[model samples]
Target chain A: MDLATVTARLLKLATKVSDEVGSIISNPELDARMDRVPANLGPYGVDPFGFDPEYLKKCMGMVSWIYHNYFRCQVFGVANVPEGRCLLVGNHSGQLPFDAAMVSTAVFLEREPPRFVRSMIERFVPDTPFISTFMARCGQILGTPENCRRVLSNGDAILVFPEGVGGLNKTWRDRYRLQEFGQGFMRLAIETASPIVPVAVIGAEEQAPTFINAKFIGKLFGVPAFPITPTNPLLPVVGLLPYPTRYRIYFGKPLQFTGDANDEDEVILKKVDEVKATMQAMIDDGLAAREHVFW
Target chain B: MRILITGIAGRLGRRVANRLRRNHEVIGIDRRPCPALPTDIVHHRVDIRRRPAEDVFRHAKIDAVIHLGIIHNFRIPAEQLHARNVMGTETLLKYVSKYNVKKLVLLSSGDVYGASAENSQFIDEDVPLMASQRFPEIRALVAVDRMVQSFFWRHHDIETVILRPTFIVGPNVRNAPSKYFRLRVIPTLMGFDPMVQLLHEDDLLRMLDASLKPGLRGVFNLAGTAPVPLSRILKILGKPTIPVPAPIARALLERAWKYRLTSFPAPELDHIRYNTVLDTSRAKEVLGIEPERSLYEILEPFRAEDQADYTD
Candidate 1:
């Protein structure tokens, strides 16, 4: 074949591949879900926190695919999320943050008048390379009280894993167990007068069943936790990938508590415990209803 | 109205002086000589800390004082910057109070809030000045802002208005943001696209004029039309950008600044990495300010073709 014919064939192949990818990414149902959600965009087509819905739409293709095909996320009680600002306090697990992604995607794709959930990421996440910019553009901000207050006041859904690294980095023995919750989320909910939607994400714990957690190693590497899973030590790169455990996301009823946000820690812990109890119950219920982890 | 403007030799001061000269008796005090100063307005070439600076107020019946004479050049020596900015502000406040000036407008900056991952998207004036914590070179400006704020409370008689405007950019303005934007190939921190705020020089002058109103006395944050990402601002100006990693960029900038090869200090890189957008609702409601210039108009001068001289 001549060079021109080869070039034309290559161009045709590129166009064909891109067209297929476009068709796969674009869904009328997803577009309809996006249309139902209210976005407060500035004149430059981004929110105050630098969230661009267009950017999110472009990036959600892979995540959306995983939601429908890979993990097959089953979401329930999304209507429990109130109209305005509310905190989505959920169990953090799966070693990686795929649980957070599944929860946010469920709310975005499955809820009525689909909601946009801004996940409060770890502080160190913003210091990472391309991930920081990608997260910001997709509507995740550094987990700070001020950012939380601002996001809540703007009437946007914010997903916060109050258990933090404790729940996420927990070993296999602690699977399906609730970690000690932080009182900050409760304080914020009371202060903003926003309801709290306790979330329970099942099957995430078994995805990367950690056998041992090495703290000193994590400290030396400047990471949150060093978990030793079976595949992690053997496969290295591929080990980072989580198992295809079917996700069941349960968003509980909106819990409203009225009191001083500046109250004592003891008082705040009681409120935090209430949220923890709700999540643990939901998680237990979800685990009982599930037949198999991979199904 | 007999108005006294300190730092009248600077770009903002000159524009303000030229505008107020039409209707009021304008008096300018600056150590630097302004060759293009209008012939009608009175100019006193004297440092504010010196004895002669007091004579400008002593000689004339100064009704109001517009204090914009802040030295924000990070290259200057620390003690000199502190002495000149803080002491100069001290001397000026003494004269304003002693002369019984009815209105006082101090030109502060939104940079006093500092760019941090911890900062809220729209920082209010109520937040503490934490810029010094990261960039110690900007401590003098933060100190001056705090000093004037205390003075505002003590002097109930004076209509003290502190205007904390974001990076002011214009054709003539040689401030950090303007010079940074003027770069042929602006270098940005890799993976970081912070939302930035910019106020046009003309809009700032309008706010300064409105701040001269009799009873509008409080610290107000002056922001531009809207806050956009730093990359978007560069895109609007049609400038090519090179995104370098944070560590390499900081190291290069430090060496370049030390050798006097670059004007942007290494610490100033934080401005491009994190958000410090200001809340302008207070200024809009109080001063009734509607920012006249859009983002494109604000960045028009720095366009690739419009700028002929690319000298640092």
Candidate 2:
């Protein structure tokens, strides 16, 4: 056989082995997800938000190893994320924001249509070198209302953690209590006429359970807040890794809002409260039902 | 129509001058040394800075002036480059006004829209010129465009059409974008894969020809048919990539560029630093001209050349 043929054969076999490994180590349900990732989708065809599909798949592969193996992520009510454009309003926590990844992966890997939710990122994300492109290429965008509106108007599912960083870096004791949610998501949902699907990600709060909040140290390092997690501040590098806690992601039904995106602040806050309340209830249910953190 | 084509030494200028010579009386002038003309064309060897350059306009009753003599090079200083491009246009504009030339087609680059973090996905021609602020080397285009834009409005008699086209790539193309494609190991900013659009040289030439048609006026963004990420282009070319951090990459590129080892200078690196795709709907609707080939087809020459190299 010619080199091209041989190379193609080798690649096919390699992808097969990888798919098998990905399926074997993770949930059998993920077998299709592993198989669906194309060999090549060019560069920008990977994501409309400028996320590279190949790069995203590679990241998902690594995350799969963690999702299916490390944390053994279990997705619930994933089908509740209705087809077409909708806002995925979820709780953001776990110090490093693994909830966003899990919630997004649940939609990407589990849903029949396999919607790659464009998670709205912070302004600093696109500014950071290398990561900015990866964030964008992986279907993530800055959490601007205009950007969110554009994504939703394009008939694409958008992922947003209404709590912003407040959902993340909360104290160990205050875990699972959703932070003050940002009202921007509600405005976006109303503006774009997109339905809001409340997602409650359990176990993200426990993954990097912090002992203390070191805001001074975080400022010293040019970061927002330095949480003293069990592994962090002590192990440094190893500390970044999340604790192997079982993850359960729940996707709630779509909630429609009829109002102007430029509605009064108090008016928007009421809708924001509704979404936050739904997420809070799901969190309580998941917290009460879970048998153990590690199992 | 007696047409005065500047930058006749340039391959595109020479080809255009030759093509225009078929029907119209052509006056081709340039400072650079050029080979023999095809036929039926008067060649003038003069620098725009000197008085002799305007002698062609004085000598021939020029009806239309195609300003293609913009200095786009890395070797020249920024001031000299600006002086050449801006002053060249000034000299032409003065004569075109003085000579009562009815039509003036000024060639500009789409880079004036600039590759910045905040630019719209597809920048329209109406977007403010931010390219001069981004890079010093790109100021020549910004200044020349501004000059033409003002001249277009200021002079009511002369019908001026400014064409802002993306980087042109075609068979045997040798500018920055083409050179960037030919690099053995293309260095990308470690994390960035900005989108790039390529206008085929033939398509660009055709657009220039179309601009010469009666009643074409105002600024227009001539978009490429297809836009692709920089990484994909390199991947298709089978080039090994070394993703250096932006600062280090900039330093290395500058040195390599200084020594003339690489075609891509530091300033042109901004093109790949951010996505800068121009919106050509205005060109389509107004100019009524569409590129025959997409950016994808424009890279076919490179692919063919690379494949031949592999076989050899």
lDDT of each: 0.88, 0.79
**lDDT digits (tens) for residues B34-74 of candidate 2:** 77887578778888768887677777788899989987885
Q: Which pairs of residues clash in candidate 1, taking residues 3 or more apart in a chain or in different chains?
A: none
User: Could you give candidate 1's per-residue lDDT for residues B24-106 as a string of tens digits?
Assistant: 98999999997788898889999999998888888899999999899999888999999999999999999999999999999
True contacts kept of each: 0.56, 0.32
Candidate 1 segments exceeding 4 Å error? A1-24, B306-312
In terms of TM-score, the best-performing candidate is: 1
Q: What lDDT is obtained when candidate 1 is compared to the true structure?
A: 0.88
Best by DockQ: 1
Kindly report the docking quality category of candidate 2.
acceptable
lDDT of 2 by residue, A1-295 (tens): 7999999999999999888676545544454564564323433364434656545656676666777778889999899998778988888888887878888777877888677677877766654677777776776776766567666776788888877777788889888998888787888888778898988888888889888889999898777888898788899868878888899998888999988889899999988888888889999999999999888
TM-score, each model?
A: 0.93, 0.77
List the per-model TM-score of the A chain: 0.90, 0.85
Tell me which residue pairs clash in candidate 2: A46-A53, A50-A137, A51-A137, A51-A138, A52-A137, A130-B191
